[model samples]
Target: MKVKCPTCQNEVEWKPENKYKPFCSERCRLIDLGEWASESHVIKGESFNQQLTPQIDEFSEDLPPADEDFFKH
Candidate 1:
């Protein structure tokens, strides 16, 4: 079957024999990679780095203290 390249919209064969499957050539594949690497292909708001840390309620006194058993030998 034939499909269009996501980067250049060029028609390409959807076969295992093509090293750069889904892309017309290595250049098109590399072009897509470059866009991702340069942050041109972002996935909307709230980045991955920001999601890693959970938000803390500053005035919430209902939280428990750190686990004391964790540091015990």
Candidate 2:
């Protein structure tokens, strides 16, 4: 089977041997990663922060209070 690379739109052979099957090459894969990392590519939906903020706020009071040594083990 063959499909277009999601990052470069180049034709790619879909096979287990192709490490970057969905991308044309490592460069294309990295480009896609950079886009997502920089927020250039975002899925359409309610922002995750927006969705979680209310839940977090509701539970904040139940969490143990933090201190300088909170994370110590």
Candidate 3:
């Protein structure tokens, strides 16, 4: 099977032998990585931090409060 590269739109062969299957070459793959690393590409959804904050807060509430005695033990 052949697919278009996500970075360059070049034709790519989809196979195990092709290290960069979705991309034409390593350069194109790295370009896509750079875009993601720079936040130029983003998934459409609620922010991950926002989603996790409530869960983290709920978990923290169940933990026992730290006391000065804890340090002494």
Candidate 4:
């Protein structure tokens, strides 16, 4: 089968003997891997916060008691 190398976009003949089936050669395959490792190729996905809202404690729960008679005028 005929396939284009994902890195160079060059047409290459695919054969069972070629270890890098989709890629034209080892160089191109390694280049593609390097790009991914360096974050050049990023996978787009939703954020974790958007998927799950965080649980927060109520603000009133953190305050001292209002009934304390500290101000005696």
Which 10 residues in a row give candidate 2 its minimum summed lDDT?
Answer: 59-68
- Score candidate 2 by TM-score against the native: 0.52
lDDT of 2 by residue, 1-73 (tens): 8999998699999999888778877656654653554455421233422534354332223333342243232
Per-residue lDDT over 1-73 for candidate 3, one digit per residue giving the tens place of the 0 to 100 score: 9999998798899999998778987757655653544355321224422544343333222323332243233
Cα deviation at 54, candidate 1, in Å, is: 39
Steric collisions counted per model: 0, 0, 0, 0
Clashes of 2: 0
User: Which of 2 and 3 is the better model by lDDT?
Assistant: 3
Superior by lDDT: candidate 2 or candidate 4: 2
TM per candidate comes to 0.52, 0.52, 0.52, 0.52
Candidate 4: regions farther than 4 A off: 41-73
**Weakest ten-residue segment in model 4 by summed lDDT:** 55-64
Top candidate on lDDT is 3
Error of 3 at 57 (Å): 40
C-alpha lDDT score of every prediction, in listed order: 0.54, 0.54, 0.55, 0.52
Clashing pairs in 3: none
Superposing every Cα of model 3 onto the true structure, what RMSD results? 15.9
